[model samples]
Target: MPDTPLDLAHLRAFHAVVQAGGFSAAARRLHRTQSAVSHAVRKLETSAKVRLLDRRGREVRLTEAGRRLLSACDLAFATLDAAQEELGQERGRAEGRIRVGATVEFGCSVLMRHIQPFLAAHPGLEMDFHLGHDLLTPLLREEVDLAIDCHDHARADLERTPLFRESYMVACSPGYLASHAIREPEDLARCTVLSLDKAGAWWERFLARFPRTRRPAFGRVVAIDHIRALITAAASGMGVLLAPSYSLQEELARGELVPLFPSIRPHEDRFALYQKTARARLAKHRLLKAYLEALNPAELGA
Candidate 1:
């Protein structure tokens, strides 16, 4: 036998193929290209010195050697899951720390509601929440395990799981709109627009809709760094805001804020949960991913 070490990637790729019965199905499940999946499986067969799959037709059939290896893979993955569940941290309690970073709007509008249930279910787990608009700073500094950021950064060391997009519609207190005779996107030029000082992606997208409305007054820019304060200023009739629908649901429902043009959706900002690719493979990291996805299901298309 060759003295090459077994790669977990190859093992996982083989397992995915066996479970999926084909490279295409496994590729979809793993978020990998079909060729990549196939290459990994082929490499596994070579390194293990065994015929792992028989792909003579549309379906792939596991050989005897492949079946044995598949069983081992199943056992290994199961054991890892169990280890995280039972003996995870201190033999009883959840045994890991995960730092999460998110914009304040997500924390207030989406994440807060899900925290109680998640924490109660995983008592041994410890988490630190950092609120900021620049999701990159904490992630680059290794301060957070993962971040809900506005882009799926395509870097060699990072992995991204799409959560949602940052789409905004113009909104303001009903009283404010009633006070101003606003008819179209051009009306924003007169209103004091509240926006996060750190980022202007949402506002930029909204403004881009109107090619000629390129003045600072269109943004009339109140520029609050904190989401809560920004929203509060808008709620108090400070000015109009370009905000995600999720962040303004309660206000809209209560009639405190009304959408200017409900039909106009801003350009989509690709939002995703980002983490170190290798660390994302860990069971605990997978759990965190699941929790965040559950909280933001609508954005995740669930």
Candidate 2:
């Protein structure tokens, strides 16, 4: 549509510059000289007849026009990459690397347990598991092929499928239950609340089900950052813990931990599997997708 056709290489240089945050970094990533990368970006701006970037020393900020072009370039590059991967897969066996992003607890407790059989069934497939708290960023940046996120934010550019709902259970060790009375929801106020944070976020969600007037105040809060450590603390009769049911299956089954509220349903957090919309058509992606979709969290606990 324009008088001059924008060069793909130049556009790539501009994109890399923006992604890397500077010309020097972009040059290193593109395997080109800094001057060369700068020239390519300048050429791209000339072709478009607009200033796409605002350069201030080492820092570069994208202009309004650059933001629009970058979005288009991202889509074009992702589509092209997907097509290339699809073609490569067609010429080879069903084997490749799948970069997966997931939360720490879910990755350790749930995903790792399920991925064993999947890896065994497909020996040729390799899994690059990236465990973190913010998986959405890496997923959007294409650093990860897929992500399992618990966020409720809507992203039109992503393909989100409800993978599972992680339900919570209020539990404590048998000794603690015997020593302290937790007959009703209000009784929780008199007991120590075990959580990952002093704010008692986990217990807050469980208590949200009760009426505002009936909500119990915590007598003491013990914050343990790690899930396993928190579980161990709760198992030692330290305090009451509201944890995901899947993570507490063994303890509950072995009678190491006992449920507090049997009749009241605790909070359930919905987690969804996310992938870039039409990003990859590779067989590895499909295989992992099908395998993950078929898994039942309840069965995993068993």
Candidate 3:
């Protein structure tokens, strides 16, 4: 004999009758007439070539075959329901991992300050902050979703957006300045200068651009490999630190460090967010930009 096809509708109606204990009750639950429900169960049993329900009892009871097949039907419908629930959880939100590459300074300042609000808003989102040296290398290699660092040339495949406005100023602890006279930028050459390891790219650029009139002809340089250590040294009166004004706001406010040549501000590029142009349209990238842009302009001076 040829095999009969199984219709899910017939199987569903049969399962409903078994679960509801009677054809009339199942019809009520399914919003169908009693005859329609009985026909569906009959079709299912005919296809299976077996008697499924013991209808002679006061309440219908499942046959042994019905009990076995009902287990299979329950498993199938349960799997479908679970898949739908998972899909619903993934819908309508930025739900994915963001691997961000940031310079040491940016990781401590802008990145740290902005991350909490975004995470609170998107419970399904995840992030990893790579604060290691030369983060731009990983960004260009596609290892990170975004890069946060000083403005620089990007390859044709990449795009950059400036995050804020920044400038460099000479600063030292109040105790150091009380004794040393730093009326001009050139005066820095006479004072001990603390800077990041290899003197960092920012300090190098600042020195090359400083005017012969205002800048030191030859400055005493102490290179620290860490930004936090550099900040600590400057606070301890180790030397004059040429640093971004915004990053030192807390120190300045608390009188831990004092700025010199307040009138002579050398503006510099703020940290920028960089990503491949191909990823510009992605929801995660757009969401990150939206949150970062909402930062307080007064505090960030963007």
Candidate 4:
């Protein structure tokens, strides 16, 4: 065999000549002169130390050595084409870590369920969820790829995608409901009410909706920082409290807590917040957007 290194041009010309069935057609397909195509085929044969063509009159055929070399060339070129195609797709498609920030209650109650299926569809992706008190600060600092929160503060650099609407529901233990004889929003004024310290805006909206009566007097008013503690207190008949419906689904199913008033639903809010810069560069943001789209209220029951 010749000591020259293999050249892709030579291999391509050889494959094209064999597949195209003649030098003239191969030259036209490759946009090269017939002589140049012939020269490339000759160089390829010399490197392999084999006779690659049998010329019978004006027609040309492949010799035994030529047939074997053509088969090897076919396999090699196919592999190279496949590798290039895959690399191109990786550069253009979405794949990478997406750090998401969410408040604790929203993260556990709603966001976590959607993540598993999203990861299943994209096994190459990784996610880091940062659950905390403040979602907007981390998002503004670009510490996370997306933020899911109830409050939508306007910022010139930030974009928002509204995921779903959720409403607050006043809940109390079955025992409390049975004992208190609370028939209307007015009756809640006489019952103890549990308050979540961090639910500032939500609490304000709740009060604004039910301004017909005075704030409830607490036999024992306890301000809790965590949602789970508030839920626990309501379940134990300690006080009536307001919380998101999604967070209270399990307890309601278990008969631990009953909705305070069937006729009146409290104030509701929509969650609409995303990073502005991230939304513009969609290749990196597609996965996060896809996950949020699946959380629409219509699909929640499914």
Candidate 5:
């Protein structure tokens, strides 16, 4: 047979099928019948002269050729979608989903407040928030459109922009502070230190800022994965815990916890992360970045 020519409809159908994982699902997505969808895929395979999918038990799997073609098709579709969004934006409209991943502390303290206003401003835009202990994994896996993280590591395929700076404060139950006679920063050395273990590097950076002799005495070090749990432990007077100021703002206002050694607080750098490929497609990512930038302490009232 003569070499078949490429067809956008065939490509679209194949992409829909691959993404939806079934002919019926793809048909529903494209508003076409299952037979029409199957015929489109057959035409695509005929054009390419290759089997694109394999039957694996009850599921359909992409053949190696299919996987490669699907990747290219995804990139092409993403570019087209981004271009369309840019045109819409130029015409005074914005659209598309913004998936954001954030650390627990940042999510509750900063992110939660801004989301409402952002949605109000962009009526049709969709937002998905994923709160995780680590921001890097989600960004790397394409699980989130963007991530707010505490530090930037060197990664050739990732791009990071410094968003803001925040300080760590040592806080403990008012009762604990009063009972322990901890009137100064140095007195913290005598108490247990509650730490969020997942905050590994950030926690170390915070500690590095302390003077050798004045560093808090390391007693029983308890590590938990969640920042809120650390805050809860500190509120119960179990130990002195270091955390971002915003995360414990409410507790501090309630007089449940007191900032330990305000003078010795350490500052941490905050960054926004996205894959280099995603960064190059800024029009697609700009709204999320703009939303986050507005939430920065200097921009927002904090």
Candidate 6:
């Protein structure tokens, strides 16, 4: 260790560099110049008397000391952020930002719908809503305060609150359904299937739910990377979609999309709100947790 104390600003710069992947990106994230960010990291290394990062042009790789220091920085920064939030809360406002991770479909539909009102009510509070298909990585890396996802693992480090079971249905525009004679599962082979993947994995799973001797193969799979885009394509009569019921509520209600084979429901996915066991007791997390738990299932349309 250095004889004198290391500057907190230098440490923060080092952490930001690793988090943002490069000096230039870190500078942008910290609202500082690239040279300034690089200088701070160099200062931090000089103070520690060890090289923390191995720089290669625009890329950077963390040395062993860098990895260790980054972990310490995460804990220290989180504690300070929590303290600041607590101080703000003590001043009688629901202040501080909540980082939320959610699946793209749910984030765009159900979660977004409910959280809007909550955020509107709490004028002082801010939120960072991150939507992705895989939320487990962000949760594990502590990039998110909490996550609403279909991850069902019973990990000791996590506290999970079961939200609801998500069901899927086959959807298409009414005109498309009428134009194409899709009376049975076999008829789906004749229709274009809108899928997130070109492999038509979702359609395969949905078809597996049916107790048929032979599964219908999707003739043409139109791969739309986003659920929202897939829904839009299905609404435009471009193809048939296999989507979660929660995401289809608005379109179904508006008669823009119609469900095919209402009797055949795909497997239900259990979505839960997950928080790190270490931060589960935080006041901001507790407030958001309670608000979500209090939501009506019928209102969510899941």
lDDT of 6 at 46: 88
| Deviation from native of the Cα of residue 115 in model 3, angstroms | 1.7
Candidate 6, position 42, lDDT:
92
- What lDDT score is found at residue 263 in candidate 5? 70
Q: List candidate 1 segments past 4 Å from native.
A: 1-94, 197-202, 212-219, 294-302
What's the number of clashes in each of the models? Answer: 2, 0, 1, 1, 1, 0
- The digit string of per-residue lDDT tens for model 6 on 266-297 reads 77788899987767767788889988888766
RMSD (CA, Å), each prediction: 12.8, 3.2, 19.5, 21.2, 5.3, 3.2
Best-fitting candidate, scored by lDDT: 6
Which 10-residue span in candidate 1 carries the lowest summed lDDT? 293-302
Candidate 2: where are CA atoms >4 Å away?
Answer: 1-10, 16-43, 55-61, 120-124, 278-283, 299-302
Model 1 TM-score relative to the real fold: 0.63
Tens digits of per-residue lDDT for model 3 on 1-302?
Answer: 78798789888898778766678877887899989988998998999999888887548888999988877776565455445545645786666678888877767766687689889998877988888768666774445778877758567667788776667777899998877776776677688878775443546646666665655654677888777788889999998887766678888889999987777666676667788665665666778877776665444566
Cα shift from native, residue 218, model 3 (Å): 3.3
Selected candidate, larger TM-score, 2 vs 3:
2
Q: Given candidate 1, what's the lDDT at residue 132?
A: 81
Q: Candidate 5 on 160-220: residue-level lDDT in tens? A: 7657677677789989988888886556567777876633443565568777765545656
* The 10-residue segment with the lowest total lDDT in model 4: 276-285
Each candidate's TM vs. the true structure? 0.63, 0.84, 0.64, 0.64, 0.71, 0.84
lDDT over C-alpha atoms for residue 106 of model 3: 61
1 or 5, which is superior by TM-score? 5
Report, for every candidate in turn, its global Cα lDDT versus the true structure: 0.75, 0.84, 0.75, 0.73, 0.74, 0.84
The Cα error of candidate 5 at residue 193, in Å, is: 1.2
Please report how far candidate 3 places residue 302 from its true position, in Å.
4.1
